[model samples]
Target: MGSVWMYAPEIGYGARQSLVGFTVEAADGVIGHVDRQQDQPGMQHLVVDTGVWKFGRSVLIPAGAVTGIDTEAQKVRVAPSREEIKAAPRFATDSETADPGYLSGVGDYYLSLRS
Candidate 1:
């Protein structure tokens, strides 16, 4: 299997190991702030708390979806549109992060959108 390369910095390239508490923006607008991030090489992801935007629901966004990270602004940019994210499989529980089946579903869903 191939590793899913996470966000690619538009200006240059380097490893950005953390993103907790960074606000996330979709193609159209800000979606939420990242509450947590996974550093796994193949399965990087961000756990975003939607706050009042989605009635406090949390979404797990694949790192591949991230476009850039602005450390100064404390923000992360993602490619998926707001609607696409809202339609993605929900990340409701902490344990779900370790479930291969659930992760596969999320990966498949985003992959489908790319095609």
Candidate 2:
């Protein structure tokens, strides 16, 4: 098998933090909520909510997508800009992520976008 990233949830997030929530930057600073997390040690998946990410149609975020992990806040900040991630393949909240074929296409498009 290949390598994978890590996530820390034992610390938990902010009290007001809501899963499927969006991280908003205000005068105070950047704050957000958690929508859902895969959590399984070997598996990698994150379901960001559409409510926070208004632009996207879906919420499946690859584990490696994270740029930094706020162990203190128990939050994950993705490396790609919000717009870049939003432009990635977005799925409906009700529907599960598409098949590998779909992921492959998304990966290809995202790779091309980075180039």
Candidate 3:
């Protein structure tokens, strides 16, 4: 498998396009909207603001989990189910977004879903 931080080749996410505000959908249903994105080559990810769903909490979704991108509909589709995404390692925005160890743990959690 490729690095979880990089988008799958088939995801077709344009480098210049912004995903902020786009709806994020898990395999089973809508989860949230993209609050922001980290597109630093090897560390791409999306910070999704799950309003009301998780009590306004935000979650970090690695790019590799993205199954598709629909610009017209302003949506992003991910491979994991809602439950699986909810169970991912908690994202500590203040301290963990740029922490290598935290990113690795998050990557491992997503990678395990493929198996």
Give the best candidate by lDDT.
3
Compose the digit string of candidate 1's lDDT tens values, residues 86-107: 9999989989988889988888
- Candidate 3: tens digits of C-alpha lDDT, residues 49-101: 98999878899999999999999999999999999989998875747886778
Shift of residue 36 alpha carbon in model 1, Å:
0.6
lDDT ranking from best to worst?
Answer: 3, 1, 2
- Model 1 lDDT at residue 92: 93
Model 1 whole-model lDDT (C-alpha atoms)? 0.81
Q: What is the lDDT of candidate 2?
A: 0.49
Pairs of colliding residues, candidate 2? 19-34, 19-35, 20-34, 20-35, 57-91, 58-90, 58-91
For candidate 1, the TM-score is 0.88
Q: Tens digit of lDDT per residue, candidate 2, span 5-114?
A: 23334434333333344442212233234466655443455666545336434456655455455554555676556566557675565234435565565455544543
Candidate number achieving the greatest TM-score relative to the actual structure = 3
Cα error of candidate 2 at position 24, Å: 9.1
